[model samples]
Target: MSEATHSFEESFDWVVVGSGAGSFASALVMRAAGHSVLILEKTAFAGGTTAKSGGVMWIPANPFMLAEGEDDTLEKAETYLDALQELDGGAAPGTSRIKRRAYLENGPRAVDFLVAQGVALRRGPDFWPDYYDELPGGCKTSRTVVAEPFDTRQLGEMRKRLRKGFAEFNVLLGDAARMGHMRTNPDAKKMLLRVALRTVRDKLLGRSFTTAGAALQGRMFKAALEKGVEIRFDSAVTELVRGRDETGAERVTGVRVEGARGSGTVGARLGVLVNAGGFGKDQAMRDRYMPGTRAEWSLVPEGDTGDLHREMERIGAQLAQMDQMVGFQTTIAPGTENDYVLPGAQSLTGKPHAILVDQSGQRYMNEGGSYELYCETMLRRNESVPAIPSWAIFDRQFVEKYKVADKFIDKKIPKGWLEAGYLHKADTIEGLAASIGVEPAALGASVARWNGFVHAGHDADFARGERRYDGCHFVGDPYADDPARGTIEKGPFYAVPVVPGDVSTYGGAVTDEWARVLRPDGSVIAGLYATGTSTASVMGNVYAGAGSSIGPSLTFGFIAARHGAGLGNLA
Candidate 1:
């Protein structure tokens, strides 16, 4: 073993960078193993995107499956995942295979471990159907698990340092309205009513209750705290330090962290795990990596500026999928510096009556496609337009039947959006198009065709009526067979200019199945690890379901910790 006599002022068995699921899971595992672990979180809060996310962990064949008598076999999983590999064209095949194997083989094991560690896992309320439902190895199952509601009070002093996404709590209803999928689904209506009642009841009972994304993150946050993981808030990792032994074997020695207390070095006796997120908000990196995107549309936290990627790259870590990122079809608030509007809750599942179009005023893709696809299309559209902002055109009737995001809609459409010209309102389709700088005649023809489809109950242009996803439910009774269908025939149409927005960048430093960073020569860099959005995503570009991002994050984090701790006789 490396001599403990090195007079290390501060050292941990493992130093986990980032506060997302990957970081927390690794720290929890190492701490549980009786190893001292210290987590350096750049932000004040420990959850990172996990806290700001819809805390579902997508694990196929989890314990919930067994309880519900669902059939999920390793063979079936392998078959499904193999199909994904075929789709990916074998990019980073080794990493992709290992990830699929880990997820399929150890998925149940990870869930069991979390449960043993006091994380209460429950079947989520709904199953977001597989994106490729028709593909082999894909089927509807209770594979999604969420942590029970977490009580932030349990964190004690730590709660003050935690950060939550400003837009997370607000409900999303505009997306559903745009798709016209469901305004009167009894189940959806009941769920909304239940949420309202619960809010009132919790207030009456002097208890706390949060539904949706907030509830999910809260549960995981509480569970991580209970496991005795040390989370340092407001501490940013400025640099990754490396050193070589007499044999010239590369190893991570420590990390330089900066905080209000002043900057200092924290040595890692075992390994350094980097889960510090992606460069979603870094203008320089975005301009370099994604030349096509407009930097203002990034919806990620301001702190996610590729610190981990830059630091790791300085030490010669290889990167993968640099051309990819988490993509979204989004609307931007007029005259605001950073206000990007995402598809409201209802729109995510395809309830709204909106379709995304390119610069020439032509529809580009399935409005119900994955957010990643939406982003990719936006980037592609930037090839032709000076700016790649699309229009999310809707009618007043659509607004009446469903809600938009709590942030966007009001008793009257926000005047700032209208006056500043980010949003355009018109009594007719032609007028609306003219206000938004589109060809009035062309837009009029498009609206007329869309209305004809709505009345005939079928979409001939792009088959918009074919969408069926769980997130599509909305409020009111639009009375349409295809729940996401509504006509623009109603006068007073509205249009909100949209751009490509993203949760985070999907591509970054590449790692193996063990979460060890790899050099350009295809060799592992001992003592170096990465997880979360800082690493190339295991899911590739397709979003299979909710919690897809965090599931692999937590899993690989555990793998990295275990691998690092088991590096016997490092000296």
Candidate 2:
């Protein structure tokens, strides 16, 4: 069938492509500058990945912390960022530096702007340790902030323009609904008991009861709407329009967007911002750029086809870190699609008690390391798959102590996984490996070594019990002396096969500190900017604190908008 067409005569001083935090923040900045801005979103709704994310923006040494009597400084923040760069082994220095400066310097301003635009900010301190506490200026501090619970009903007609699916927002809303049901009906025990308990705890602490991802996105969405920014959904920019200016260089003129009924061209007098997401979900691009991953395992939305990246590439934009992608443990769910098992961070869940092994059944790096490192290590090992599907082999003691992300006591493990023969349950290590088609002898030896470390309260093979890594902790027993150690001595052993799952790919088109897309010849692509997961992420390989992804996305997006408006040179 021929592509659908949509036409309209609309012009804006600024045009933003994508609706995540970055695009929304940039659009707000431009609008604040007294420019009429139009935001084009490919999906039916706005709030790209930002709506589905945790909504914590990681801004080290932010003013919000200081206002709340927390101690943080730019120098200390820089030290922490530098420590992360050192861990990258100099592979992403530019990304690290740009993101660090953007977040450290502009973070406070970004928060202020959003708050002024009706976004409520609550001081949500970093509950986990800093990834580089051993380095100078690296200590856990209250540097994160989450938006207050926003009522989606406030959006009125605008709510219809949001991307709807299993996006972060939807996930949060779904979970919240379940939680809310439990709160109103205490007699409905079982799973509802957990929900009711969480609701009461949050309410008692004066925290927003909206714990799901949607609440996070809703806050940003509410802030953007209050700023008078108009979002056009179902609008996919097909091609970039450029022309020669007085400086004998190319400049963006407008964009040709294809929609439902017809196609139309919209012009931007100031600039065009491209925040379209990465090419993770695009099989052809995945094969060409990231050959190591299984193309079918992407968890991104269907709308994320990398059209913006390809369009920019045609115009001679430079790309960086194309080989890198955000990896996580994933599994093939029968009848549906591949489902990525989210990372178990100290903040989200708790320290992992299991170790990740390769197909040969040998331990690799620390299982509690950053997911970025996990992905890199998996690729370096050259496993049969880009990321080998492995088991989180733990004894009964682990299951009794810590709660896994989705493996609650009440909910039955999905039949798809059990029937497909991916999960293995056995009373012994040797038997468990046999059920999963691994060599019995190799699995036995691996388990024996791990068991020794668990029993001795030390992990010499891969330091499984070490809590030095900030990402290693979880939400469970924080008071446990050996936070990372739990004896695997229970009789009935369990094995859940997990493959690598990523929130989103971090590598993309390279941009400057102001989020301006640079050309192949080291010149700025006039009127062109990018943000969110579409640009090389500023975090590099280290996840410094919670909300790291959204933090840079908003900060750089603000910088890009100000730069586009010639405000970067002010003061």
Candidate 3:
């Protein structure tokens, strides 16, 4: 941290940190306002964690929703978020009624601004429901929006500099969910074939295409480049340079950055936007905030260290909700611990013929609905029961029909998985339980109770499939008679350990509704703005819906840029 009297080698009207989804949005706003903008990314890749994400934005009452006549309004969105806060035991420290209203009010406006800039955006599947769709004001038809698939060829020579998604193929994240069901569903099979053909065609034609977060970032990257927003990869903002304003009040005026060209200070005339992401890769910070979690479990790609977090703290920025994370569960299979794409187990646990059990062999939570809540439940359940590495018990029927760790169930089960004790197989439920060190009687009783629920077509214990989000296609089996409920009684049982993984930590520097970083005294740090996971999430402890984090990140980034440019209340 430098004193308030620092010199700079160069400067821009606005300097944005981290090229996530929000960074580009902020830069675009500044550039559109006829201000020079610079985006600094720590990694060689342009996109931050957003490039590796699903790229969905949970924007309520977006233009597409209104165009389609979907039932969504600002009041309803507020009610839904309010309900989430209530369910989480009141508003979290990072979120308030004002902040929530700001997010809802500006979410659609932000999307509209992006669309007006010619960014290709579209609504997610209408079948996609809110995680808590049954709650008052929750929309069952979904409020998620995503960018269309982009051709990296459009990036020209800079295409190689763009970060690739977890999957190289151009398949929508939602479609990828259904791709696992190709063996049973003809539509899924067709979609899989179409994606396969597209991949081959693109390869043959010497074209590069990407989807999901990469698609979103790719489009934004192209748009920014076209608008003449300069982006520098491998450039990291190491320390903030503070200076006194006209009123003799301290403010952040510039940033000292280091990259391939070495270190220097770059001045910011308007403000510096920090969208540098969370510290998911910082094991020390994880140990400090989220003690029981491992950094390796994070789905976020490399370079999410906490340099800015410490820098901001050194400058008196208040950090809140540091213990929160965007949980997305994953199963660690043999030889996959270091893989770029580990198989996600969130939807697997909710599929028919599968049940999650603690070490004592007891079902504890509804396996469906929000993956965020699902992983949170696992961690919470572990406080009493030994469930940090819970087991997903299933049968031959499941293995034959469904996927385990992104691989189809085949006769050739990986020898390493079984030998390393990551996967257990047995001819009977009792044998499976014993193999996993659970009492036979307890495991048998749990399976029997689950089977009874399947027969009755009702989950009396947790209501796993009762919610609109929990059924058929999203987390359930489309071919199953009950879709979400099925018996695990077939012989040749299997069990795999499941752990709470995450895309990123969901906490950091605290900010106001305008996205201005605030000190503990509730005073704004002039010329300092933050969005994305770099700031304590405005949604608080709750993951409101798909892309809740991304939506807020983009919306707040837009708001921050507009505010910094003296454009008040654009929403």
What TM-score quantifies how close candidate 2 is to the native fold?
0.85
Q: All models: lDDT?
A: 0.66, 0.65, 0.88
lDDT by residue (323-421, candidate 3, tens digit) is 889988899888889987677887688888899999999999999868888888888899899998999999988888888987766577976888899
Number of clashing residue pairs, candidate 2: 26
Question: Can you write out model 1's per-residue Cα lDDT over 1-571, one digit (the tens) per residue?
Answer: 3523233458888998887777777777787788988888787666676665556677877788778888877677667666765676664422576567765666567677778877766775443555554457775544677666544455566555555533332233222233343344445566556556756765676554433444444555666677676678789989887765446666787788899658888888788999988888788888888886755666666579898888788888887776677765555554445443344322632444555555455665556655676667667767876336676677776666555444435357765777777667889888887788888877777777777877887778766645444233322233445556667677677776666777778888888778888888878887799987888777765666656677878878877887887832111
Give the per-residue lDDT digits (tens) of candidate 2, residues 457-514: 7779765544454333233233355556555556576666555555667767778777
Report the poorest 10 consecutive residues by lDDT, candidate 1. 169-178
lDDT of 2 at 40: 85
**Candidate 3 displacement at residue 93 in angstroms:** 1.8
Error of 1 at 426 (Å): 2.2
- Please give the clash total of every predicted structure, in order: 30, 26, 1
Comparing 2 and 3 on lDDT, the stronger one: 3
